[model samples]
Target: MRQPENLIEINYAANQSSVDVDELGMRDMQRRVFAEKDAQYLLVKAPPASGKSRALMFVALDKLFHQGINKIIIAVPERSIGASFASTALVQHGFFADWEIEDRNNLCTPGGDSGKVDAFLRFLEGDDTVLVCTHATLRFAMAKLPASAFDDTLVAIDEFHHVSADKDSSRLGQVVHEIMSGSSAHVVAMTGSYFRGDSVPVLMPEDEEKFTPVTFNYYDQLNGYKHLKSLGIGHHFYQGRYTDAIHEVFDPDLKTLIHIPSVNSSESTKDKIEEVNRILDLIGTFEGKDESGIMRLRTPDGRVLRVADLVDDSDLMARSNLLGYLGQVAAKDKDAVDVIIALGMAKEGFDWPFAEHALTVGHRSSLTEVIQIIGRVTRDAQGKPRAQFTNLIAEPAADADEVTTAVNTMLKAITASLLMEQVLAPNFNFKPKEPGEAPEPGTLAVKGLKAPPTDRVRQIIETDLNDLKATILQDPGFRRAAAGQLDAEVANKVLIPKILRERYPDLNSAEAESLRQHVVVDSVVKAGEVKEVGDKKFVMLAKKYVDLDKLDINLIDKVNPFQRAFEVLSKSVDPKTLRVVMDAIAETRIEVTAEEAVLMYPKLREFQRMEGRVPSIRSKDPHEKRLAEILLFLRRAKASQAKVNA
Candidate 1:
């Protein structure tokens, strides 16, 4: 049995600063958001288990009492997440008031849609200050109630990525647009996964610009932890059914959450309940369910493992029983459960602090879902020194027609891991180096790094760097470049700017270039290894060591941001499988567009002038090889055009 490969292993500082509460019962992340309470349109992007719910309470309470907001309408993606906003006694923890929602006002409980919507309307009109409901309920309620009904209310949407800018497809997003456009309601959007997995913009550029972003990055949340010291992210590929290969990566000793593939996915066996039972049998002999409905499995050894089967939701009673038990699990009793097998229920907004390992058994299509699943195990808890996320993917068969799809899925998984690497590492403050300027501590200066030319660019660099990189890593062009099919410079100078302009259409050429430089610089630096030799530190960029303090933007741009992912892929998978992956990529990789050819033509000429010869396709240099490919592409285009004319 092959063990899981560790692609990204990041250790935190364990400073305990993030978990520490301030005078107002707010954790470090909460306090950061609370300070921006005055902004009517605020977006708080924080990692899970970072007290985003409590942070909303702090801000909502302030808005209700001080900001003249008449009511607080809190909407979550699902009903279970409403519990995060359940009435809390904040005054006991040194706050001005408590966050109390009357039972009737808490519209997230089990009930009919019409009844919940009626209750929602009653609460909005009545004297109640806070109401909790799911996004579906809110969307339904908004249909019945005019946008004016939301006037003077503070609407807070949790897991905000669910609301897309595409109003036609996203009803919740349409409701939000209506409220913002037709009424004067204050809005606060919060999300653990800032970027959506579907690649849709959560908000239109104009609407997003209205919100003042308060970003509490994963690095700050994890690095300031009290107990969790490190996080490892990796993927394992199995030739056949994943159930048979479970033992390869499954560790019974760790408190784990196993997310089985959805029945609809190709990787699934199509029988979720049977899959769960198969996993149970593999683990040990099934003793039976205990009184609380949690399955009791006797391992090969004497130890009995408590498994929660969320996949078998046909038995509502048993599912409810397990949910109740999981709800009571906390830091005090970290070992209340052993493993959880679920198809889809326990990803976002599901809190389990004791979860040390999240073993996901398929390629998660959404980066957002991956982030949330990882969040389940990242909570700070006593005795839980480390957290892990493992992706179990199906290896592509060279003979299969779906091999292309399989290869794409494999690359997507790799990209997700790479993005997490960027997210989990410590945040770096990068600046343009100035002549004779004194070196600053904790700040990285790169020669020729473009400084932000506008406030909009500055805001993007400050809050949206990871999100930008997320989009870039997922781009087909960047992935091909990372696989060594194209030049790193083409990806850095051409493909990256294209994404930036499309995402932020308002950006001029200069602004887009500035943002592009920052994205490339940040990614390349974070992807590189930092080494300290004696008193001096050096960073390995493009496989060459460069003085960390004297780095250059040009040097960083020459590096493939996903180079580490490629290296990991080469090491983790067998060469045959790797060949399959490469072949699939080459077969489907986007040909160089005429626009991209136009962009590279000048650079190709410059290369020819500098080297005193046209670049060779067989050149060891990626940049030269890319130019050679582009030259060939253009010549083929010219010959095809001439033939058409004749």
Candidate 2:
């Protein structure tokens, strides 16, 4: 039987502030971006379904009519997302102007790139004010037209994380660089997740610094929602085929979207179409396909389910018909589709507002993809008070050669949870405690928390905190540290700063330290508990309760930022399976370096004095065992030197 490991469950206030409209008909996130409508290079980092598309429309219209911009070019990652930037009636909602686009201006319809590019070029030369196209079309158009052709245009890229800083591989990135470098064009970049999977940055440091950022985190979007009050992210572990255990987590009552594993992934059955059929059989008795190709299933309880099958691609015409029907029906009626099972089509920019659950099989290697999939079910809807995301993974077998891979996948899943917790929690404002001064209502005053000393550091801390944490959590060194292979302080002080310097080479030493401290503070604080006791609030720092007034950076540095992940793993997984995971990690433990030996030598002497003998590898304490490993490492090095001398 597969059991769910509900790692993090967050409850929001649901104050209905996010959806509240202002006089200009803008939601919270849109209002924030529209305030900075004058920025030539603006980046909006908000969650999905937070009115980001309309925010772009608001800003693009302002630029086109008032900001001296001649034309607007909105490019999306795919044709499906192009629908987001369609014509709008802003004046009906209290704005000064209305957004209108001719039918021929939207190049996202079924068309070839060559033709779209030609249409794009024609629009650029004509008197039209706005045109929508796919990113590929923009790339193709840029190849033929010089950058000067877009001198007075506003280029807005949706799902902007797809544009990487690597000029060698990403033609869209090259197109952006060319346009910005050779012409005086206003650019807007928007994305749900700012970080990428491969750790390659989305933009160069210099180029990123030029943009003014508007960061509306997940907390703001969810906490201010009118309907969604809570969200839960969990993992379900199955020993054998995932299909055999799908019923354990698949709840037919909840509106759901299921993403089957990719064909190349380890958990995949290698035949997606057959897998879809098998899932349908497991759900209920399959009746037959409807006129629009939707799979109809009759459950044991005598209820019929309308399931959309996107994995079957053998018949293009039938699939097109199914897609067209889904697009039209999903918008108007909540009961039009009961379930949507897709392989790779419905992950990004697929809007299903009534979906209450997003179930995924197999570990998604990309955190961005995971976030996007989670976004599909997070939209606020009537009668939907909660959203849930569950990842179904295969448990490691004792005799399997790929046990290491399985363990890595599990650790990545855990880290992704940790990152999501940071994303979903409310923002913290940590300030230095002053003598006889009272803290603000929602702020924390610490004795030794270092304030950001530079504006550059401050900006990064304010806007790029989650992105910075994402980079750190994905680092190989941090992964080892999270697995208990390295000391906590070393991870906090050494490895973290090294990563920051590499990520932002322009930061001075002081700025880097400040940024590193902010990261540690934010992660540790979010992972711990905060409770109110009478007039004083107490925070749990490394299992000990400390007054919020006395909390300091030194106290925070001693605790591992990832301690909660390990603790959650211990409680979530069975003892035997956890032992398997730990043993697999131990097999590939990092060797003790000389610098680490220097750090551990004092602990080694202290252990000798206390135990009246050398530390033993069989000890129950992890640190004591670590000292023993260091001793063995030194002995081996001495022996190797002796052999060389001989």
Candidate 3:
């Protein structure tokens, strides 16, 4: 593959090389969560590498030694993360005790009982301080033991984002809810990113308020890094397959970990052998093996890269053997393997300290996934002063609406996240989007501020985004509008302004409206819905009018970032059929109080009685729940009012 003429490169300023030293006796965020002595339920919202795992150890140990806790169960999402609780040297780091875990208790190992009910039961009978297992194992324990058996025990859920606050969640969520309701157990919930982009709260507000929150920020972690200087995140689009675009974005000289797209992706041949061959052939064929049996590839740039193929390819034995050697490596040797090519590996909790870049070939599956993949490169390495994450997403040739919508929606989400990251980093300032000069979608640039953000500014932005993202996940009108497809008046005027006012009660109508416009502009531009004119750049909102400046909230054009993307998604679904779905979504967002929703319910049922069916076709949508809640609230309210009158 020849290098494409267009090569997009973006660089960001480095963060400070060191952080403020913490006082002895407590880790960074642990001090707050630990100090909440009156609280039984604790929620720790911290960033990755902020010592959250150790914080859990400290809390769990306190529960056992001081509180009335007999057994402790630590549940993680995956097997690899189980190692987080494995016998760490916490005592040496100024803790009361070491996290002592029996080797046998780590039940996520291969052939071991990942559903380790018997092991949990046995541990309960005896005296085991901590039993580390996967989420699957925790579910099995709940099934085997009586709910009463959980009494006097402390259950800590790590990666707490997986536990949906709503009833629609899986066992991980159901298990925690049951533990809270049915048992007298203490719960400590921890997550690197507490706000799930999916909109389902990990715990309902009523449940969440009971827990004391220990929070950390991105600004804190990055500003205090020991070795890392700066971080860059970029998204590059190609004409066809990502493999062809690899040369356009990937820098072979940088120590990188390449995650080959899944077999389902256009870049993957669905055959591992062919993928490896293509990667090697694109870079350079091996001239020969090195002294230590490392596969040396002389790239087109003429630099030799010690490539380690984690996937089983034509050189199966050699690739497999090199992987074994990497596993035993205690510390990074700068002279070691230069690249790691993996398929379904090296993603979460897999540490390769020397890695300088984490490059991928697709729009990440979820916002959480994008965070985790970027985490792979952000870790500080000895000689590496800066790190980067490159997302080489495939841009299919413009064809029908369905494909285009999927691509654009994905691009929108990716760019929004990237923008958020830079804002939260060391110093960031996003100039209000001026009307005539919008940056083209997928065009790369880094914006930084000279002055650092005050703690107040960081808190406000975080609160605004956290609230906005939650609405994006759950609210039909807002979600659709944010995607820039739903061109409803309420979303632009009523819905968004109302939210901003609520987040900042002090803001007047004018201030709130101005804030709302800037937000909409951010969404529109980042979602890849803008185009360049002769000299001015115009955002493609309604009729495609060139904008003069960023502060004009009331624009001459109708704005829906997803408007174009929605057109693409709409091509697949019949326009008539989509009207039915949209109607249901709007009707369900009933926005009534307990009394109003309840009163609305029987009315809803009567309407259904006349109409012969529920409003929505999708069984799992939130509006379904809202419908029932409204009816119940209305009936109960009337009944109580009758009682009061009597």
Candidate 4:
């Protein structure tokens, strides 16, 4: 479920955890992450359950116990995630000392507070080696205390996504910057997710370079799993809100965690009581509160199902009973938690090992939210082999005649946009060039670099590739190659390798050649580059497809996940047909004054007759749409001018 759209079987040595040196020894990435201990600042871009908390422990311990660091402050977004830094078994694993987080200093638990603002100053004045505090508390304390007060400490921030360059997050960001500038405070920023939906830089370019980055790709983590096998991400479209179609995706047999839509979500009616009642009814007969004030419910088929309501009801007893169950790691009774209805809880650090499926009912626009929900079910439990994430989105129900225009263009677009991000990481198809030759169109071949490449430049081409996505199917040369119009010998053995090297300059001649063949095989298998082979069933990559049962993992690792989907999408719709749609939506350019637009009203009427609807000023609409806008604008301006004259 990690960037479900862009899962590759690529492995990194850092992903392999080192042996348990003591008891709970460091993971391979953890071992490698610690090797950068000498760095003044570090950014560990690891995946969920990649033992980031433990890694931070080893580094913080080194800075405190070994290095001459004065103090260590750990900040997390939520109190629950603070438990990640709780006392560890590291001493048993041969570390110099175990991490002992005092309950009093653990602001997450009940303790003295002028808020944590006052406690933070007290802790800094004392000799506490490590203090775990939430970002809000730290932000508040930093306001009260001088930046120098936090100097000489290693300040580690978890769920680092919330710390960004935006003004909303600037409070904590400025505080961290101030503390670092005032004194020599080192920072270890950690986040499981890469990008925030709003597209703000987490750290400024120059500020970011100060930290050494250690990345553990999702493919590496899930691939290295001992018990968990494959992770599946799917989208199920239903009529109206998911409330209208819960039965389609929900399975009582699956240990599911359903993320009900927020009030703002299109699927949400925003009626919490109605939402709860509807869900309870779907599962079973809601027989009111049991002896313990918990809701007792039975399914339509006579099967007993225990449901825990995470939403607070107006009734104090019902709300209090649910609050009592808020932070429990797991339900005490085995049969008690068949389904836990939650909002704003049970996510990001709450562990539920029994979860087999993570289901959400909404259009979760944020990629960070999507990844976090997936993490809910990915935790490996004994005997549990696979996990799934299903997004139940509202599909518009319009009659066939209105499918293209009225049914729900916006709805489908939103759904496709969400799925596209999961299916494909924004891609840039880069190809390397020969000496003294030009780079491939829409690709920047890194060549003649006096110094090594930066992650930024490389990432720009990779993540922001959509703008420059190549028109492969439309290219004459590629089309000829696909249609067998070109000579096979020259096309396959020579031209393809040249293009691959041009696109991937990092790949040497041999590597490029290998990739070229793989790309060609991929192109042909997709039924785009090669035709006349009826019913293409096999796909050959780095190696030839050998048998039905086995696949070469190494070659499979390099296969692009987007190509299969791309081929189906591309082949289904004719390019010429798409052009017609574009023409239908295109707006004709015009130069007209307010008076002139009035004169063109009859011309606008022609469009209304032709299209069978009055065109409006739409950025996405055709030339006729612009005409309507122009006429309307002119009429308004003319009216204003007439008023002035009078």
lDDT of 3 by residue, 1-646 (tens): 2222211222334343223324435654566566763468877776666677877877888888898888888888888678778887767667778788998777766555633767777888887667888888888778776777889988888888888866766767778878888899998888766656564656654565557666665556656566776777655555555555677666777888888878865546678767776777777768876644567888887888787777765576675466556654512576687788888777766667778888887665556666667677766666888877776655433342345344444445454444444334433234444335555453312232111134333333433353354344334344345344233344555556665654455555555554555455455444433466675555554565544333233552146543433443244334444454344344434344443343345656775797686654343433444455455556677899999999
- When sorted by TM-score, best at the front, the candidate numbers are 2, 1, 3, 4
RMSD of each: 2.4, 2.0, 12.2, 12.1
lDDT, candidate 2, 550-612, per-residue tens: 888999988889877677667767888877877787676667777778767887888899889
Q: Tell me the spans in candidate 1 whose CA falls farther than 4 Å from its real position.
A: 329-332, 598-629, 640-646
Give candidate 3 misplaced runs (Cα > 4 Å).
1-27, 36-38, 165-169, 195-199, 287-294, 313-331, 400-402, 409-419, 426-464, 470-646
- As a TM-score, model 2 comes out at 0.96
Worst 10 residues of 4 by lDDT: 1-10
User: Cα lDDT of all candidates, in order?
Assistant: 0.86, 0.87, 0.61, 0.58
Candidate 3 C-alpha error for residue 237, in Å = 1.1
Error of 1 at 594 (Å): 2.7
Report residue 518 deviation for candidate 4 (angstroms).
17
* TM-score for each predicted model, relative to the true structure: 0.95, 0.96, 0.67, 0.66
Ranking under lDDT, best-scoring first? 2, 1, 3, 4
Better candidate number, 2 or 3, judged by lDDT: 2
Q: Candidates 2 and 4: which is better by TM-score?
A: 2
